[model samples]
Target: MVNDSLPPNQRRFFLTIILGGLSTALAVVAGWPLFRFLSPDTGGADVEIVEIPRASVDVGGAHFLTYRGRPVVVLQKSAGEFAAFSAVCTHLGCIVKWVSDPGEFLCPCHAGRFSTDGAVLGGPPPKPLEPIPVVLAGDLLRIG
Candidate 1:
């Protein structure tokens, strides 16, 4: 409780200090998540490789996965060949989908299309899908 004996000016000063401190604390609490999200990945471990079983991806099919919190796609182009690319659309931040019949990646947000090889096919996408490295180890696929 505020001291009843305190002068009006002093009481106002004390209240101002308390309110300022509280508002500062509240701002920090609310802003921390936004700050972290906007900040780049500093001092974070780089995702070098990700292992996935061959059986999980069918022939001529695409498999979606996450790498370091980013979306990624692994496409089995043929019986023994597999390719990987970023699932993020180049035009915008929308995720791309695998269109099996046409054998391409489609961004539902803007109708952007990308070839199975990650090349741009149609719509507003400015560039091809970003390629990721993929290697076959025994019956597993290693992606980076």
Candidate 2:
């Protein structure tokens, strides 16, 4: 209770300070719970699967497949395991071509060459192709 006997100016100053502190405390309390709830959950160790099939891709050959409507390349290795990577070239975003003769994925626009394992072998591309995670699920291959 404010003492009505207090001078008006002094009472106003004290009331203003108390209200400001109350508002700040209320805002912090309200904001903290929301922040904790809304923060991104990035801690899981599970792989997110994209869909693919168990068909054999020939070595020195490339097959283009779509996952989530995005283009990906399925390459067969000399060791017989299939590896999937994004078809988009790291150099200038051009689509890469599978050059069967040299057994390399080639980006025609910049002469960039990537090995069957998605390693950048030559020209312009500063990094390897982005590999999509693939796993065998029964007869189907799941990619992510």
Candidate 3:
């Protein structure tokens, strides 16, 4: 018959090992999703919509707006047509600047440049700017 009672040292050692294993397993399960959530870009699957007032933006100009308090760039193509893209640079997290003279978005940190259409013309950026889907409903512009 197995002894039901053991010395204090033996009991403590077994308990510690069991607890350690449990802790490690718990960390692996919980940490994976947490790390992914905290990542800057969760791939291209997640897209959202943002709205801006028509009068608030200028034609041939890029407006820095916010949606849900997150920064975004709104580009006015004409009187009512507009396109939107995330201000975040593809190369790095640095915010991109809209230079009206060249009709391009420039990342000052690394000289990354993106055309008005969000195409990466020249720079270290691996991909073109992230285009946010847009729709104009009366005076409101929605980007997703």
Best by TM-score: 1
Candidate 2 residue lDDT tens string, 21-96: 9999999999999999998765432535656556655655667876655678887665447788999999899999
Question: Each prediction's TM-score against the native?
Answer: 0.70, 0.60, 0.67
Candidate 1 overall Cα lDDT vs. reference?
0.90
lDDT (Cα, tens digit) per residue for candidate 3, span 53-91 = 777779988888765445679989777778888899999
Per-candidate local distance difference test? 0.90, 0.81, 0.83
Instruction: Count clashes in each candidate, considering only residues at least 3 apart in sequence or on different chains.
Output: 0, 1, 2
Ten contiguous residues minimizing lDDT sum, candidate 3: 41-50
Model 1 misses residue 10 by how many Å?
Answer: 24
Error of model 1, residue 14, in angstroms = 23
Residue 144 shift from truth in candidate 1, angstroms: 0.8
